[model samples]
Target: MRVSVKVKPGSKKGPLVETDEDGSLIVFLRERAVDGAANEALVKTLAKHFETRSANITIESGHSSRLKRVRIEE
Candidate 1:
């Protein structure tokens, strides 16, 4: 499955995930957007939510942006 995500890094109300009306996902992480920490957290959180391993999720696009495209391989 491929999903679009909007990441909110260093959020106080975070570690939360939700789906937008456009079918994109919104993810809030407590980690800062530094040293790829936010990306790592995104993968970890998505893995847990999708009931898959982190290795199965790949960032397809928007590596340096808040909006990201992730590929979840089965």
Candidate 2:
């Protein structure tokens, strides 16, 4: 399934995930958007949130943007 995510990078209140009323996801991550750290964090974090593996998550777009589209193989 593909989902839209609003990423909060370098957030102190991170490592958290929330869902918006529109059905999109708001992801709070502790990792900063440096050297692709936040992107990597996004994958790993969502994996845990969905009880899936990191390899199962794929960032389809928005590699350097706050909003991203991710594909999760179910």
Candidate 3:
């Protein structure tokens, strides 16, 4: 399955993920947009939310952008 995500970087309460009003997912990352920290955090959060392995989640688009398309293997 594929889902849309909008990331909010540099949050105070660690990483958080929620569904957005526009039908996209909202991801809040405590880490700044440096290296791949935020991306990794996103993956972890998604994995836990979907109750799947991190390996099952693949970033299909927007790797370096805030809006991301993630593919999850069921």
Q: What clash count goes with each model?
A: 0, 0, 0
* Cα RMSD to the true fold for all candidates: 0.6, 0.5, 1.1
Candidate 2 stretches greater than 4 Å from native: none
Candidate 2: lDDT of 10?
A: 90
Q: TM-score of predicted model 1?
A: 0.97
Q: Mark the regions of model 1 whose C-alpha exceeds 4 Å error after superposition.
A: none
Provide the TM-score for each candidate, comma-separated: 0.97, 0.98, 0.91
Residues 1-74, model 1: lDDT tens digits: 88999999999978899999999999999999999999999999999999899999999999999999999998
Arrange candidates by TM-score, descending: 2, 1, 3
Task: For candidate 2, give the lDDT of residue 71.
Answer: 99
Tens digits of per-residue lDDT for model 2 on 1-74? 99999999999999999999999999999999999999999999999999999999999999999999999997
With a 3 Å backbone cut-off (N, CA, C), the pairs that clash in candidate 3 are none
The candidate maximizing lDDT is 2
Candidate 3 error regions (>4 Å): none
